[model samples]
Target: MLSLLPQRILRLLEFIGFSGNRRFGLSQLREGASNHSLRSILCAFTLLFYNTYVSLILGTGEGNLAEAEALLEPYQEKYPKGSIILFYSARITSLRGNLEKARARYEECISSQQEWKQIHHLCYWELMWNHSFQQEWQQAYRYADLLCRESRWSKAIYVYQKAAILSMMSAEELERTGEDLGALFRQVEGLKQRLAGKSIPMEKFAVRKSRRYKASNPVPLVIPALEMMYVWNGFSIVGKRADLTESLLVTIEKVEQQLQNDPNPTEYHPDDSCLVQMLKGLCLKYLGRFLQAELCFSEVLSSEGRIRYDHYLVPFTLYELGLLQKQQGDFIKATTYIERAKTNYKDYSMESRLHFRIHAALNSLKGSPVSTP
Candidate 1:
């Protein structure tokens, strides 16, 4: 785990007389996982967690899915209906872009056992994202609501996610549900809590965003849930399914038009427009419209001076633009953009998360074998 820390964080740790070896750490975990010992499952879980979740979220989406699956195979055979096994299996499938299969497995995992409702809560979170990937807003909202009402983990994030999902709903659909959007967003800050003497980065971001809803006439967040999706790297997973990516592009374009037509523009209009462009660029990149995607990304950077609240957008967009360049086999140019994102930005929302990604991307460029065939 220490070895997985971002490069800058590791440098700080080194100054304090601490260091970590990624290879040695992975080897020890692998040995433990391969042994038939009492803690073998725990060892396997650590590896699986790193490969399936950590690498994707923090890294460059270059997770070793094959290794994760192989590590789970025997344990899955031994405990066919184990809740934990099912949960990880579902996660692996989800990461592989098998959303429907992953969704069914998550349901099975939830129903497999009732002794640990926390496991069910985990399923709820995955189910919410799975539904969101398909643009199934109503289904997604149900799981988000469940997490808000029952889960003890990060009520602020849950509540914010619930409001964000509702923001995606059509006006008539939102009205039918009778949910006050602004009220839900307004609840985010009061629900936030600190952990280990530090505020959670994402919760802080949510609270900052919820400020928009504090006004008497609140300007709604533009596709807030989809924005959250980008934060969580959901686009990479959804990008595997062309239909899903195209659907997301359609939704983004519709919102883009709505933003353009708003006669009463606020200070946030430029920020909102850039946000939409960044997301649109991701969709375009995945859909193989490289020229169009690059244009969208360039537009965000070009409008940087006009952005007010969402300063993070510029750096994050640079990171995305770098990845887009990487996808097109421009390694040197990709490195330059990604390096700029890492070094040129500071004190932004999710700054640490972006650093993690930059670290992984640099590692990948240096020929790290993060993927499996």
Candidate 2:
């Protein structure tokens, strides 16, 4: 909760039009209100709500579930129909492992708004997570499909990964019931094939990949953590796309310096190196250095056995190459690269990525050489 004094300070600053500074601050006022005025009361209410929303978002990001929930509870009371508040509250609940309460809140959010399709998809995702926790394979698969239909790529990837695990569990259950294991294996293989050739957008994949790596590797945490902090400061200085390019260059330089100073170069993980190269490639692409980006991406793709697990790096690189080719009006090469990405997505359960590749392929086929940035 925001203190009354802080609220008064903010009001005074607003009154004096002292909103130039981006950093959060409190300024002493000349006089404090002895009696409540309508304007003062409204200002206080606005400040309270603004503080609560910011606290809830930051709390969730920091994994502070208790604080997030406490901040959201009052908003839920004051504005019962606010679906955004309910969604955040439910997210916090889900994070805290209270699936039943989370489900109730999500359901309420869905019921509160019919126009917001994203909320509906979110509710289904929550349900899918709950079902997965209980090892209910069939129910989980159904909800997963629903989520995929809604273009919830990250959550959809999670669902398909769970489905693969569940398939193995189901195989054991079926064996006890005298069912054929070979047939089950064949079915699983077929599903994998279907999901193989797709790719997710590079930007979205980078964000997810960074978070995943952050859990295990401390190196990649620096850039993303700094980016998060930049956002926290209201994106005041680094809000522009141009700022992102500068930041990316800085990060690439830092990574390069680290690599140069390392004694055992071969001992360094290929994934980490590939990630750095990929970031450089993305920055080049953003700066309209198409050929350079192409070379960087190509080098990463050609490097053998760099990634141990299923990663979207290859497909993402291929997709970007296609975009570059399209920009250069090389429709033939663009089509080939995008088609390759699509094939990879089909093999990798990256349906969302495949969707973008398909659009690119379609444009190429139609002889439309100009591509959207």
Candidate 3:
């Protein structure tokens, strides 16, 4: 159990940046102290140190860097064998743009946690992070392959996606490398098959409604209409705009009316509202009502506090807003929105069709080059 202490500590560390580390450390100390006898003071102290270390790893508010460092300093002194502390310490260094130190710490983590399957995911993430920073696709691909072999499916998918992204990063690289663009398509197809035997339905409104309790507010019709807009975006990306135009426009109009009619429409849900606004903006943009499209994007930007992490619409809105600004010849404002989109893209878990549009718009801006594969 003491050996598993490091992993537990690391998990806590990941959350500390978002939630304070001291509070988390104190809580763990209380729990462990309460359960163990007086002679177990050493164990209690170890747990406390572990928890504190985790808090440092997770906490990421403004001006907390010194506090994070102070929290870790004691652990380095108290538990010299706790190499996981070093791994997390390196993450902070990486966040500060100290790439060499971060690379070394991750390498140490890989060496120490070689036999731990669960920890392999973290190792892969670290490797991917390092390779991504250095733009070393071959190394990244190898690490990704190792992750897939180790049964870290989600991380593997991300690695493969990153590979595709790097290939798309530069046309010269793509042409010289002779990379297969179909790799991503093949991986997605394989994932679909692996998931096929399982009954994981796409997360449409009906599926969500059926899974929830009867009194749990049923999915509003507009929610599905918004999802249809995402479908429209996908088709539009694949040059199937004609297939989605009529239905997508009609659905958007219906959703807009529904939003106006319902005194408390579920569209107020941040995720749903963002999607609705984004789709509305897309429709208006395509219809050549640039001003109305800008309004929709502005509405989304203004509602940042209500933004949901799961919704891709926020970044989509930012990207669209960038395009709209670019069209209006507001280069500086366009760049700002595009940069916001790029930052948000780090958190986006899935590759969507709308990204191509964002990339195209960005390429037209000065200092923003589109990578084609």
Candidate 4:
């Protein structure tokens, strides 16, 4: 709390070259947490926020789970049933790919709080993703539906996510939701909100995606829940579990086979097929089937001229291709593909998110610093 500063002041400091100081930040937090004052818990809260949430969002999703667990350990023992502690513990476990434990902890957190419904909303969000990682689309949709109907955090996201999860379901499962995906998507544009007089990038992305369903003969999207999962970088967490990645591959393969057997092709045929291939590539990459993954990504690039809608696919495929090469220790090839993806793309869905990933990959590459592309 003591270290908290206004955004304008912080920006000014950064502009003058007094950049963020992790050591200084940690020192102030440690001192504040140790003090015998009413503000001590607030200080602890700040530290927990950084470790459990901020770090994961800003950097590669491979977070310091050990550090986060350690920070929450004392609090866990001290406050056995504390809602806040349980929440962070669950989040850490989730990041570490311990879905069962995370779900249990989140449930405990929900049961531990009743006065603040916001806490329940948070747990619901976590539980939703836990089911998503497990490929339980119906269960995931239930929580997303709850958020859409109940939480005020982000109507645009909750509604789109609720729709996307339904997109993953079989016809019968989708019917059980009793909601039209197209109607839900049409609601996305109106639900979008602006932050600082500009539409939130993620909301804009969702709005653009919802547009696909706006056409008269709308083509159904392929595994949209997993696509959104990639957008939010959920793949990083899912990658830690072989079972999760395998299940995802299985889903993608089923979709691939269905597309193969289609007798009548639509105008969006190439685009939708390529989207599935890209997602399948990601799953293959995660499962260490690098050669097959490379083939899938290459096919997307190969189909560039045939794509009618969703112009964002190519650059994203490039980014995924770069990551695939990087995993194979081809730093030179990796840097080339990633740089092209960063430079060649503009105004695409989740552009900033891709940039963050590209920047991280480039920085991790050995030798010369990566160019801003």
Candidate 5:
């Protein structure tokens, strides 16, 4: 959790108290996981969760997949149809960019048990993202709709996600669903709730985004689902496949052309275009078109001052540029750019999420080996 703190706060903590050591913590967990105790499974689970999900989402995308597999091997053998093991197996596969296999595994997990609707909720979430990573908006929307109706995890997030996925569909496709997109977005704010006296960051982000639809004649969000995809580090998962990355680029470019051709652009036009350019940069970077990716990122940075609502774009783009630099094996420049992003920005949408990624990136640059997309 110390990794989540700002640098200045971390420094203050060090002066007042000795911070917990990650390596030591991991060592203890490993010891507990190896022992034949009641909580051994819990220890193993903590490790598996960190290695499989947390590392990829909060840190760099270099999750220890092999280690996660090793940890789950025993559990899988003992309970071949265990929902949790099957779910982790699916997640590991998804992280490796095997969307089809992951989808099958998630379905298997869901079918393995009926006593736990919460487990089904977890699988639904993965299924939603798996379909999303494949750009199957209808199938994705199906899962999101299920989550909205069935899961009580966070209605605000689920409803907003449902609306965002619908935003990706064509008018006829959306019409067939008979759901009002604006109404769904309007539900987001009221459904939002505080957890443990603090608002959830992603929920708040979703609520703020949904606020746009509150105005009369609201300007439609451009690729809001894809934007949330980036927020959740979904691009890193999709980047594992050249075909997927290239397909995403094609979608972004088409949208870019449409935005460019608009005669009377709204005030949010620059922000929307910059959002597209950032997504394009990520796709290009994953496709090994580093020069083109850099140009896309630079374009976003150059237009930083003009971005109206998405102030987060500038710092996040800097973070992306840092990752691109690291991919090119330029550690010095990578650290410089990432540091600037971490220190120079605050109070933006998803700031906490970006800080987690920034922390992960710096750690990877310092010692951890990062896999290139």
Candidate 6:
């Protein structure tokens, strides 16, 4: 508690892109959690949140699930009905790819409280992703729709998510939704919210993607739901489940084939296809098709000059390629590419998020000069 009292200061440091200060914040929380005082429990909770939730979103989705579980195990038994504990517990399970257990825990988390609907919203959000990982489109849509109707955290994201989920369904399945996908995407711009006098990075990304819907004759987004999932680093988590990754790969391949045969091309064609290719690389990397994965990532880099709308794609592909190179025993190449990604980009969609991943990659490469893998 005392250690985390200055957490807002630490967060401000991270928000401004200070990597060292974020490390210091985590260090202090670790020391605090080592103690046996009353606030030690609070410190543990803070650390657990950082490891289980914040790190996954802001870093590489490479959270320390083991440490998170060790911190929460005792308190979880002590306060089984504690909303925040249940939340972190569920998150740990989800990160470990235990969706069924996570779903039950998230349900318990929701039913544990009625006063703080915000807590319920968090669970709903996780539940949405849980179903999404399993390709349960309608179920995911149910949670996303609930968020769109009730949550005020980020209405643009919620509404966009609702529409994205609908996009994943069969026409007969989608006919039941009765919601206009284009109109919902268009609604994103109007529903966007600002934070701390600045536009939220993710909301801005969503609004930008939704811009096509505003065109006189809109071109449907190719697997926009998967695109958003990639932004959140969801692929890293889902990659652990072969079934999930294969399902996502199938969806992406469908778009890839469509793009190849697209007779009516737009200015954004290369950019769109490159985006799909990057996602395919991610899926392929997890599926152990490393050479094919490298090809997909290189295709994005090869077409970088042609990309118009999504400038972020190049740097992100570089980062992904760097990680793959790191895995293939090429430390110098990995370090060089990851550093280029870190230094050569700014203000793109989820740029900061990708920076954190690049930072993690660079750090590991520095620690393993001979290549860890």
Q: Assess each prediction's global lDDT (C-alpha) against the native.
A: 0.91, 0.51, 0.52, 0.82, 0.90, 0.85
When sorted by lDDT, best at the front, the candidate numbers are 1, 5, 6, 4, 3, 2
Q: Per-residue CA lDDT of candidate 4, range 1-373, in tens?
A: 2112323445788888776555687888868877868877788777778766655554455556676676677778999899988999899889888999999999999999799899999999989999999989888988998999899888998999999999988889878778898999889999999888988888888888888788897877778888888877788789889999999889989988988889998887898899899989988888899999999999999999998877788998998898788777776788899899988878777666666656556655747434433
Candidate 5 least-lDDT 10 residues = 364-373
Top candidate when judged by lDDT against the true structure? 1
Q: Candidate 1 residues 46-140, lDDT tens each? A: 99999988888888788889999999999899999999999999999999999999999999999999989999999999999999999999999
lDDT of 3 by residue, 135-196 (tens): 45567655655665666445324433444434423457655556554343234333432355
Model 2, residue 58: C-alpha shift (Å): 27
Clashing pairs in 5: none
After superposing candidate 6 on the true structure, give the runs of residues whose Cα lies further than 4 Å from its correct spot. 1-27, 370-373
Model 4 stretches astray by more than 4 angstroms: 1-51, 366-373
Total clashes, candidate 4?
2
Q: In model 2, what lDDT does residue 47 have?
A: 37
| Candidate 5, 1-373: lDDT as tens digits | 4644555667788898857456777888889999999989999999998888787778877888888898899999999999998999999999999999999999999999999999999999999999998889999999999999999999999999999999999999999999999999999999988989999998999998898999998989999989989988899999999998888888899999999999999999999999999999999999999999999999999999899899999999999999999989877778989999998989998888788888778867876344433
Scored by Cα lDDT, where does model 2 land? Answer: 0.51
lDDT against true structure, model 1: 0.91
List ranges where model 2 is wrong by over 4 Å: 1-240, 265-268, 344-352, 369-373
Off by over 4 Å in 3: 1-63, 78-81, 134-139, 153-156, 169-179, 192-311, 315-373
Q: Kindly give the number of clashing pairs for every candidate.
A: 0, 19, 7, 2, 0, 0
- Number of the top TM-score candidate: 1
Mark the regions of model 5 whose C-alpha exceeds 4 Å error after superposition: 1-6, 9-18, 367-373
What would the C-alpha RMSD of candidate 2 be, to one decimal place? 18.7
lDDT of 6: 0.85
